[model samples]
Target: MEPTGKTVVVVGATGPQGRAVTRHLLGSGWEVRALTRDPEGAPAKELASAGARMEDVASLLAAANGAYGMFSVQPTVGSPGTAPDFSAEDEVRWGINVAEAARAAGVEHFVFTSVAGVERHGSEVLPRNLVSKWA
Candidate 1:
């Protein structure tokens, strides 16, 4: 694919899946805008060195004009040594926030990463309680 002049905003760029996707998009010649909480973090710095436009989430949304695609992937609340304050509600909120932001920004293609079956119930009142909130 000819990604030249086409920007792809990758969310969670510091994470595993987001990093892989960002790398692939960059390799395909896309103008990559990697969004992260900490722009000075190792992963964001690495992507910046690789020619990506590393920006915080707010700036990323504002600069998404003419963007061809967006990849949203928020990490689940569960994992080894995760903060005890984190909850399933936070995950659902993150997913919804990303989708709404992308839509409001008019991104041409919004690629939402969620668990397979969980997506069907995203709007349900109990989305956060599902086994896989990504759905």
Candidate 2:
């Protein structure tokens, strides 16, 4: 694809899905700015090596400023290697923060990736990780 000359900020860009999106966007000629808590981590470094600009979550709004779009993803409760005490409320709060920041940054498009099965199974019956997405 021809270069669009557009930039997209990706939250959780070191995660599996996020990494895939970041790589695809870069391959498609869209500039990618990646947000990660651990900018020095292996996955984050890998994305940087692949041409993704890295930023910390605290500076997400600034990084997203003037960007054309944003791709957002959040970690789930009980996610392997994640914080052992992860909470659904925390996930929901993080998602809201990213969305609000994107809006404040005037992003043209906001693509939020959430868990599957929330529609099939109601929030009450779903796991905290899945229910957090519904919230």
Candidate 2 error regions (>4 Å) = none
Best by TM-score: 2
lDDT of 2 at 95: 88
User: Model 2, 1-135: lDDT tens per residue?
Assistant: 788999999998988899999999999999999998789999999999989999988897899899999999888897754688888888888888999998998999999988766788777888766767666
Candidate 1 lDDT tens digits, 17-126? 88899989888889988887678878789989887888777775575666778998876766422466767777777777877777878899999875566555545554
- Give model 1's TM-score versus the native structure: 0.77
Worst 10 residues of 2 by lDDT: 126-135
- Alpha-carbon error at 135 in model 2, in Å? 3.3
List the global CA lDDT of all models: 0.76, 0.88
Model 2 TM: 0.90
lDDT value, candidate 2, whole model: 0.88
